[model samples]
Target: MPCVKIDMIKGVRSPDEIKHLAEVVQEVFLDKFAAPNRDRYQVITQHEPYELIFEDTGLNIPRTEKLVFIQIFQQGRSADQKRALYASLAERLEKDCGVPGSDLVISCNRNEKEDWSFGYGRAQFLEGDL
Candidate 1:
């Protein structure tokens, strides 16, 4: 399972645009990470310009108000798959949503399947509810 949190500057993207971005991210997971089609877990949070702050972080890549920070919590995947997923997201987001890949930031936190509790006060993956 992948639970995504997208942070962005408010008003930079419309509600529809955010939805499209989520779709693009999930598609990459499906294509490269073997994620199930039914596993769609995504959320977007908009912040006032003053609330979200960042710099080049030594990459020297300038950012703009359109910046999107995507954080994903999920089980482990191969490094190669992660690489492809990044590239694919960068490419697809820029092409489909008009947000340049340069404006995107992605980070992932990996955990065991036991870490997830889908519902009903149960650990679904571990308890076989999934």
Candidate 2:
């Protein structure tokens, strides 16, 4: 299963946008991981630009624009699969979400059989949660 988390500016928050992002992720998974349904993934969006605090350290945190971060975890996928997935994801995300690839940070975590729980009480995708 692949889980994507995006952190962006508050002004960029929109349900429709998130829905599109999820759809893009689902499409990528289907083509790369052979995941049959969108239920195999989790996508979370966080509005963090308004809350970033780094002034104390003299580090500037840009608030005028948004920086998006995507983290995905999937098991039983090959290296080629992961590479293709990220490549597709980055392209689609930039095109569909209007977020530039340079502003988007994506990470993929691979898990072994004993490393993840996708069924029953674990983290299976939920409908209403979206």
Query: lDDT tens digits, residues 1-130, model 1?
Result: 7788889999988889888888888888899778888988888899999998878789988888989998988787888878888898889889988878779898988988888778788998877777
lDDT of 2 at 95: 83
- TM-score, candidate number 1: 0.94
Q: Model 1: C-alpha RMSD to truth?
A: 1.1
Cα lDDT of model 2 by residue, 6-80, tens digit: 555566757788777767777877887787674455656565565632231343434235466677776677788
Error of 1 at 76 (Å): 2.3
Clashing pairs in 1: none
Q: In candidate 1, which residue ranges exceed 4 Å CA deviation?
A: none
TM-scores, all candidates, are 0.94, 0.69
User: Ten-residue segment with the worst summed lDDT in candidate 2?
Assistant: 52-61
lDDT of 1 at 60: 85
